[model samples]
Target: MKSLTSIIPAPPGWYARWRFGTHRTVTYPITTWALARDTGSEHTIVVGVDTNGMWPGGDDERPGGEFLRYIYEPIEAGTPDDVFNPVKSPADLASVG
Candidate 1:
């Protein structure tokens, strides 16, 4: 899971997957929104997501899983002024950790 800032929505467009034989192709890019954190008390779906987690490819190319980032609004902030803070980016995540 990449950092929230690193989590970017897919560009608005049609992405068609090839069909097999007479099967219909799925060409719509579904947009999804969510959040990830180092810790959380509640989650809408699953939990314990390691943003730094990775998945090895069959050819051993990119091992950082199918996703490169995770997007989400913070539940509670680090401080009172943090509520208005801009979202963080991958470079920002690199600086923090």
Candidate 2:
């Protein structure tokens, strides 16, 4: 079985996409539990997750068990760019509109 660290890859283009989407700049918390704080730039937003070891399954078994909490965060637009950077600036919005 793959370790959680090995299974979860670092987010690709997270900084650039997040910066562009929210229009400001954003920073991730040093630890995973902290709520992401928005930098309040024109179009920036912060995103985060909690790693509280809430998974189910016995200590001797793999994590894929009945009691596991399957938390699914929806990525809208069904595309990586759309899901990551769904919004553009006001000027760009005008053109798209």
Structure candidate 2, residue pairs in collision = 22-43, 22-44, 23-43, 23-44, 24-41, 24-43, 24-44
Candidate 1: regions farther than 4 A off: 1-6, 18-22, 30-97
Candidate 1 per-residue lDDT, tens place, 26-60, comes to: 12222432243333433333222222222111133
What lDDT is obtained when candidate 2 is compared to the true structure? 0.27
User: Ten consecutive residues with minimal summed lDDT in candidate 2?
Assistant: 25-34
lDDT tens per residue, model 2, 60-86: 332322231222323442333223233
- List runs of model 2 lying over 4 Å from the truth: 1-6, 10-50, 58-68, 75-97
Model 1 sits at a Cα RMSD from the real structure of 18.4
RMSD of each: 18.4, 17.5
How many angstroms is residue 32 displaced in model 2 relative to the true structure, after the best TM-score fit? 11
lDDT per model vs. reference: 0.28, 0.27
Candidate 2: residue 4 Cα off by (Å): 6.7
- CA lDDT of 30 in candidate 2? 16
Error of 2 at 60 (Å): 9.6
Q: Give the TM-score of candidate 1.
A: 0.20
TM-score per candidate, chains pooled: 0.20, 0.18
| TM-score winner | 1
